[model samples]
Target: LTIKTKMLVYKACVLRRANLPSVTALLKQKRLRWLGHLSRLEDGRIPKDMLHGELSEGIRTIGRPKLRYKDTLKAFGIDPDQWETLAGDQNRWRQYLHQGIKVHDRNWLQRLQEKRVCGKQAAPESPNHDTYACNHGHGSCKSRIGLFSHMRHCKP
Candidate 1:
């Protein structure tokens, strides 16, 4: 399907029906699994250190900080502070992860439905005519030929 296809439609009609996860869900699942593994690792391991490390002294840019992997855990309803404890038990972590994924997926689907409804209500109806409007603030035209002619010498 084209990029113009609505995500709610695509996920409901294709991904959910096919029992396939969206790329985002898959990535989050994998990241959480990897985090569980890292949490179980022995101390001082490079990957685990990187996951938990913070720079002691660095010049900060004057804006919001960049999002880290642990920050995303909140989206799955996992507290970043408690994730290590939760991931300590292999079987329990696996079960929790699955439940979290389900919760996240449900929330995501609900948000998409809300957005679709809101967008429909907010969007203005397009005029039914063979008119073309320039995206660069130029005037519109009644036909493709007129639009093309206007565009040839058009300036933003």
Candidate 2:
């Protein structure tokens, strides 16, 4: 089993046991927890604010858009439109996670991990790149995860 760190660790994530709180639950809970924390702080400059549509002032590339934490949530059947406000009610957040856990599966785990990785960079450009290695923006990931299958399973 992995150390089970919360989201926003800026590092690769892992999930082992299938019969536990799904990785999706862990991540959603973490994000919602942080959302509540940030809302309590009442700071608009935080990065989380940008996620909540607080500010929109940048132009992004049109093609091959980078996957975001929001996209990862959508992959799990979550509509993050009200995610920021939803976090305020801890019980509601827990209820959402409880509902999410009921349906979380291996496909959700694999794709979420893939989105987390893709958030750091463009997809593998080098065909010769280590397909089985996790170039999870840490130069390398010690988890020894294979991105080839993720590559096949998840498309940008």
Candidate 3:
């Protein structure tokens, strides 16, 4: 069996063992795998996020809600113009993927919308201390802040 098929089966077994929703097993696996793959891409962006099983099974799953290609491309940091040919021609969609454009995280948008409507706590309020530090003694240091303020008088 192909890796995709194997992954689906494995996920099915896991979900069955866990007593979760086995009917949507394959769909959940596909979405998770897509996100995992995107996180590893060179561009640091997600791929074109499709409605779970849309293009995976093609015409057989035609009734699935397909995402807007333009929005998908934007989420992945790809210029929509770069996918102009694919955007305009349905026949070229698969070919356009050969050019290395990625889909967005399909579940992410849905979750964001749900959070908004349900008034749930959305994003984390805290920042990563290592990345956004004030440039000094570490851990959002006050020393760094004093240094930054003292540096304003120095000429380049």
Candidate 4:
């Protein structure tokens, strides 16, 4: 797509036509799959240990805390308290994962559509190029860009 292409437009047209999942969705799927794999691993395995490990030292610097893997799982619609139980059964976990992904994608698309609609509703009307003028009343402008440039320096 060209640099001038709107991201929302590109996502709706190109990605839908190509039947591709969004990069974020793919990453979420991979992470959840790995999490499920780790969940089923035998106890004392390094990966499993690390997945369940907690920091014992080093005080947090403060501001906002870093995001944890569990946060992503929650974002994927899994409850942190019950994720281990859910992941214990491979078949159930697989089904749950697919359903979660579908729900997440649908919600994401709905939000995007809402954003596009709200953006269109809130946008200012375009000025007529032939008679465009700065709000500060510098003079008439030949184009939208010229009007913006003039507005920058045309102080009231």
Compare the candidates by TM-score and give the number of the best one. 1
The TM-score, computed over Cα atoms with residue i paired to residue i, of candidate 3 is 0.19
The candidate, 2 or 4, that scores higher on lDDT is 4
For model 2, how does the per-residue alpha-carbon lDDT over 37-60 read when each residue is reduced to its tens digit? 665555677564665674348787
lDDT of 2 at 29: 56
Please estimate how well model 2 matches the true structure, expressed as its whole-model Cα lDDT.
0.57
**Candidate 2 weakest ten by summed lDDT:** 9-18
> For residues 1-156, what per-residue lDDT tens digits would candidate 1 score against the true structure?
343444545565576776665667678988899989999999999998997788999898999998666766876788888888999999988887777787778788889889878977956865544458866767788777778888888987
Cα RMSD, each candidate: 8.0, 16.8, 19.7, 7.2
Can you give the TM-score per candidate against the true fold? 0.66, 0.39, 0.19, 0.64
When summed lDDT is taken over every stretch of 10 residues in candidate 1, the lowest stretch is: 1-10
Clashing pairs in model 2, backbone N/Cα/C closer than 3 A: none
Q: Rate the local accuracy (lDDT) of all candidates.
A: 0.79, 0.57, 0.44, 0.79
**Compared to the true structure, candidate 1 yields what TM-score?**
0.66
Tell me the lDDT of model 3 at 52. Answer: 26
Ranking by TM-score: 1, 4, 2, 3
Which ten residues in a row are the worst by lDDT in model 4? 1-10
